[model samples]
Target: MGSTGDSGNGKAGWWCRRSSSPSSSSTASSSTPSRTFETRDPRTGDVLAHIAEADKADVDIAVKAAREAFEHGKWPRMSGYERSRVMNKLADLVEQHADELAALDGADAGKLLTLGKIIDMPAAAQMLRYYAGAADKIHGESLRVAGKYQGYTLKEPIGVVGVIIPWNFPTMMFFLKVSPALAAGCTVVVKPAEQTPLSALYYAHLAKLAGVPDGVINVVPGFGPTAGAALSSHMDVDSIAFTGSAEIGRTIMESAARSNLKNVSLELGGKSPMIVFDDADVDMAVSLSTLAVFFNKGEICVAGSRVYVQEGIYDEFVKKAVEAAKNWKVGDPFDAATNMGPQVDKVQFERVLKYIEIGKNEGATLLTGGKPTGDKGYYIEPTIFVDVKEDMTIAQEEIFGPVMSLMKFKTVEEAIEKANCTKYGLAAGIVTKNLNIANMVSRSVRAGTVWVNCYFAFDPDAPFGGFKMSGFGRDQGMVAIDKYLQVKSVITAVPDSPWY
Candidate 1:
């Protein structure tokens, strides 16, 4: 293990110590020593795993294999039921190895092992099963023809796909993309975020174990600009599904346009707001609001970062919110009692600290934790800032860390106005017992998913995506498979009566 100032977040020289086989997925070729890199633990700033770094040439290999699998292999050619058989087997394998996968996810991404083991890992396998059961159920419809032609629509796979996932939820993101694409009969080449690649690589190894055909799924772990750009611009890839910052989403659009003009679906940035009305239960609101922003150390895309409280309960809410923030245990990811962990890396750590500084300079009240807590790793205490203006940098920008911004409102109309002020429309949460307010606010929010009295309620059966600059296209549910499928209209002359 070596650290020389450069981390994987755009710098160089830091080296990770943990060893892994590139052959976990395939017979990876030997690369120049200068090209490989490593992933470090966020809690201790210690090297965790050494991954075979990929560049344009390696992306070419993965894409070529993926294209071949999509074109000639049994995967893309198989019936939905046949494909489901393999997917179900893969899910079983996931269940069998849940503990190992959870540990890898915990070590690599700084995700709580409890979260990985209990929620993310099982949800991942369940995701595979959800899509697997729906595999044979994917179908199109028939159109009534008034004239002389019999017409129907056929939904078919769009061929090879490129999936670029973020580091926050490595194992879940992998299955979220791979499951639906496979169910839709599309082979995929996945490029997991460089910060956390161990679990994704492990998944490819499991795919091999579950009897998924070679070339059906390939994983290349490298920097976004290198392997990710190569995969995005590849001419053979039919579509690309990406989840990350909005800026990168636009760049991916340009890359797709420059290449084959591939189909692109993106789930981008969010400044999701959680609004609590005076009529709401103060304790329930406080509990959910803390979990909304601080869960996963606030690394979630749909995290309710903006907290709005009604003026009637503003002081009480702040007092309770600060108390709730302190209850979050920030420590090692592997610790059984830890509820919060360090930032994913040094870059994110610096970014969160900078935001906290900006919040202070902008006149917001730093009611609770607003600084780093540890000496060895990238750890920060759960922070809360009250009296935050909507235009403040911390409130507007997507701070992908455990930082909360508090705002006050007088009326429901004002709350809705403030919540919808941001460009991001990923998700929003409202805590109120009033049925009319809940129903009205749920419909009025610009975000894709709205929780009336809950926060972060997600399921495989629900369609999730962004609405504005947060980007578009759905991730879960049967609609997710639609992004990877093309509908073709077929018409035939009725009884050969029309000659035209």
Candidate 2:
């Protein structure tokens, strides 16, 4: 395979190459790529790298390599303890190259370089090490059954997984999906979002250096309609792990069913709510709520975009929120003090601006910061809207941007009712002094993960996913490894068994 070596462009070449057979390897199609796409720096719209666009043929090659790896390579056949050592080594490599990886994500996806260094990079390493610790712990149960047969269950890797990650947190999502699948002894064909493929290709290189077999981890950088659709629908891919929009999640599910009925786990979209009760501290509520929506320019799936505040504090919260939005800095991602970065690309930038206009047309009062910043790049100011009705477009839809919608409710019942009104239920946040109110609302709300008095409190041990239109299956816990595994029941008759 044409691994991560520099071509004439001074950028890394395609991680996976087009091959005549599973074992054979060659460069891309010709001296030049049949199709090429430019990955840009979201802060300046400067060309970061010219990526070779992978098509169906390229996808086929990657899938075949992964299939061969799972079937014949040493990865799947290795003992859990042996696999754990390699995974731990990979984790060490991630930590060593944290700064470089963080820089790549900042330029490619417009992630805050500080956040990329402190939170995103470290978090990726933590997840990898967490799953590495879990690799040696994957075991099945010995069952007691009727009759003279001895029965037990064997937990085995579900071969050849296809991992399609979003662009928002490329490094984090890469480890989020790839780490557990690798720990579970399954080879993977990862299709990183087109906007941010640099770090993923680098990670593929790191995996090889960490002693993962060549075919064990393959990355194909291309658009979704071509590379993504092919990976989702490939017959040799036994399972698919995807993190993206609900609409595309549905399409992947349908393709999985129509093709080979492969196991699919999707972590999709969210129109999450942050509920603030009357007794809550206004400063704390304002701070956490802003962090929820404005972090990562609101590209996060679990962003608390729709905020429900009690009537008593609605006026005060909205007042402080406006000041906060106005003061929130939007600038170059590499700046140490920049609070938020630009949208991943022009498409998301336009989508968010269009939604802000829709919110205005629908009668929601735009309080402050609805405009874009800078003469270049896809930068948008932190926006706040008050008097947002539950039925309005901004409140109902997942406008993934630095936009917040504030609505007021009178009572706990009303808060829960209005919060649950949305079709997506990925995550929610509750801010209250009263523990009883927090418990009541947390139990009443239909979200997969609820944070009380905090927001974006993600941990490797805690499982995260969605309910309803937000999509299904959990990620980021011990349960995550199960998504890449299959349970086989083994039953054998004893020497004196009646059946025998």
Stretches of model 2 off by over 4 angstroms after superposition: 1-33, 495-500
Supply the global lDDT for candidate 2: 0.88
Error of 1 at 109 (Å): 0.8
Please list all clashing residue pairs in model 2, or write none if there are none.
none
- Measured by TM-score, how close is model 1 to the native structure? 0.94
Task: Choose the strongest candidate by TM-score.
Answer: 2
Candidate 1, residue 76: how far the Cα is off, in Å: 1.5
The estimated TM-scores of all candidates read 0.94, 0.94
In model 2, which range of ten residues has the least summed lDDT?
1-10
Candidate 1 backbone collisions, by pair:
none
